[model samples]
Target: MKLLEPPVSDYSTVFWDATREERLLLPYSGDRPFWYPRAVAPAHLDGDGEVDWRPAAGTGEVYAVTVVHRPGPGRAAEDGPYAVALVELAEGVRMLTNVVGCPPEDVVVGMPVRVCWHELSDGRKLPMFTPA
Candidate 1:
């Protein structure tokens, strides 16, 4: 089954473009990295929040995980038992992504993973994770 396309806005356009090339980019302010691409970094709210788009190492460890028994909207029931994980990237940012290439039961906290891509119907690539 096809997954829903992620919303791409002007602020996140660079991120989406990097994903298309099989690379991961994160928004940064100074040395701190953040997710959910925005014009301003969460830490530099007071001063001028200059966002820098930078490449990520694309390696991370699973911080949390869950097995989905029931598929949500736009998902197929036959694809049940998928592993959804919160991965803490090497840059110290956590992103919600699917953990594939292995059984859901095998996904556990602190498990190492690497970036992978899932192509959407609209030609956009969605980043996912698999065992590193």
Candidate 2:
């Protein structure tokens, strides 16, 4: 399905850029393990946060999940439900994404998954997970 793409910004742009390369970038500096691209962490008291990029193994466990019977804009029109999951990466960060290569009903909490890429028409490769 088509998801809402955010306007380009200095911080988030770097994230989208990395995803295009089939990589996932999460801000990790001083308690910022799982922040989404926008606000990476609590603001540093006296200085900008030391943000750096680390290559994630892209392997994770399913932390939580839901079966989306109702599709949204740009969603694939299929029989019905699809799997959307909150995955906790090996790096100890959690991400919200879909579980593909398997049925939504087959996905279970604590299931293992590996990163996969979905190439968009705009040339962006978004990260999704499939059963490992």
Which candidate should be chosen as best, given lDDT against the real structure?
Answer: 1
Q: Across residues 5-43, which tens digit of lDDT does each residue of candidate 1 receive?
A: 778887888888888788889888887788867877786
Question: Please, what is the TM-score per model?
Answer: 0.92, 0.81
Local accuracy of candidate 2 as per-residue lDDT tens digits, 6-40? 45667766777888889877776654454565454
Worst 10 residues of 2 by lDDT: 38-47
Over 4 Å off in model 1, which ranges? 43-47
TM-score of model 2 relative to the true fold?
A: 0.81
Q: List where candidate 2 sits over 4 angstroms from the true fold.
A: 30-32, 43-48, 73-79
